[model samples]
Target: MSFSLSTTVVSPEGEQLYTFEYAALVTQTSIALVQVYVELGVIEAIGSMLHPREIARIAQIQRLRQDLGLNLAGAAMVLDMAAEIAQLRAQLKAHQSRPQNELF
Candidate 1:
C-alpha cells in the first residue's frame, strides 16, 4: 500500500506520463496482479512496469471483479471487447470524417 510519490515515467510512445508506483497503490492492487493482467493481454506494460492507461484499466478490472463478482477471465474478456469497440468507434469516426469522394 506504499508508493514512491516522485517516480514518474513516460510511455514508450512518449505520449503518456504517470507515477507508476502511485497508480498501483491508488488502485489498491499489487504489481503481481498488474503483471497477470499484462499476460492476459488486458493491459500492456513497459518492461516490468505498467503504463498509466494500463494502471487505470487494472483499477477498472478490480472494480469489476469486486462489484460485479466477475472472475479474472471474465474481466479480461470484458476489457478485450471494450478495447475492440473503442477501436471500431475510432475507425468509424475517421471514416465518417473523410470526404464522400474518398469512399471509392
Candidate 2:
C-alpha cells in the first residue's frame, strides 16, 4: 500500500492556503505570472501562501482581464470598486431594515 502526499496547506480555521507554484497550477497560470501578480499587488499573499479568498480574487482578476481586455491593474481596480459597492449595498440594506425611529 502506498500513500500519496498532498501539498495543500490549511490554517487552524480550516482555510486553505496555496503556494505560488500550486496556486499557479490551480489558477491555470504560470509561476512567473503569479509572482508578478503578487509583486504588483494584484494578489495579496501572506508571505508565500495565498488564502482561498485570494484564489477567488485571482480568478476574478483573470476573468476581468481576459473577458474585458483589461490590464492587471485595471482588473484589480475594478474588483476593488465592485467590493466597495457590495459593502455599501449591504450597509444600505441593513440600515433600511431598521425601524423608522432609527433613521434619525
- Residue 102, model 2: lDDT of 79
Q: What is the alpha-carbon lDDT for the whole of candidate 1?
A: 0.75
Per-residue C-alpha lDDT of model 1 across residues 1-77, encoded as one tens digit per residue: 55566556666677555554665677887666666667877777676666677777888889889999999889878
Candidate 1 deviant stretches above 4 angstroms: 11-21
Clashing pairs in 2: none
What digit string (tens of lDDT, one per residue) describes model 2 on residues 17-57? Answer: 77777777777777788888889888889878888778788
lDDT of each: 0.75, 0.83
**Residue 15 CA displacement from its true place in model 1, Å:** 4.6
How many clashes would you count in candidate 1? 0
Residue 88 lDDT, candidate 2, scale 0-100: 100
lDDT of model 2, residue 91: 99
Off by over 4 Å in 2: 1-4
